[model samples]
Target: MDASASPAAAAPDPASTPGPGPVPPPAPVSRLRRLAVPVGAMAAAVAAFGYVAAVDPNEPGHYPVCPMLRFTGLLCPGCGGLRSAHAFAHGDLATALGSNALAVVGYVVLAVVWLLWTVRASRGRPLRIGVAPVYWWGIGAVLLVFSVVRNLPFGSALAP
Candidate 1:
């Protein structure tokens, strides 16, 4: 050590130290407040399904034609989604699948995700979907395949 270096210089300054002040605790979260989002979302979905159930999508001009089906003469992945939802809302699983299996699957998935979200929120924990990039790519690939297959002669059953 250098002789010029002083021990006082190495010492921590008391003036710079933080005081023992009382810090207030965070406000307690209410259960209703935590559950509000999930409940509202569920209500919105139920209302939408109820609307679709009341309206007949199978009837011509009741709903807008699929843009891809109109322009390209090709069945898009979501071509029969509305019809599927209508059938599903009416408790006709067979017709729902016949209209659009993917949409039916989507409805089921959404319900499951919503249920999970509700459960987590009730416990004051935030739910996260950390799906890998590969999973997203796989989903895209499935949609592309469904679109292509539903338009083919062999896949006429999948058509809307």
Candidate 2:
């Protein structure tokens, strides 16, 4: 019990204290689990495309006309999307573009995004597509312009 040698001085150094070793890495994901969501999504899309390809949307009564076009006699953004999908599924690029160029572009965009999503999921890193509100608003504005332009005689080429 010397004045200079306190009880605290007898304690062991924290750095030297024994504890659990370094943590192990996370378990690898199962192959089936890795492919499940991407595969399922692709299968569903393929099924829908297949249906559209077989059904012939150009035939009257096969698919309902867009309500906006029906009520207002004005082409909406999605007026010819079904016909575009139908033509795209049949490998008719020109017909697809003629039906709705924007919808054809949308198909290409969806394919690219789905490819990236599948690749990331297979690698055990899921993709999170988070677009800002401003970008969404810009997309809406573009769609509005497209709709308005397609309805005008000057932009009749875009009409379905």
Best model per TM-score = 1
Error of 2 at 67 (Å): 0.7
User: How far in Å is the alpha carbon of 95 misplaced in model 1?
Assistant: 0.3
- Positional deviation of 68 in candidate 1, in angstroms? 0.6
- Number of the top candidate by lDDT? 1
lDDT of each: 0.93, 0.91
Give the distance in Å from residue 138's predicted Cα in candidate 2 to where it truly belongs: 1.3
Q: What lDDT tens digits, residue by residue, belong to model 2 across residues 14-83?
A: 8789978678999999878998988999999999999999999888988888888889899998888899
lDDT of 2: 0.91
lDDT for each residue of candidate 1 in 1-160, tens digit (9 for 90 to 100): 7744878877778878788767789898999999999999999999999998999998898888988899999999998999999999989999999999999999999999999999999999999999999999999999999999999999999998
Global lDDT for candidate 1? 0.93
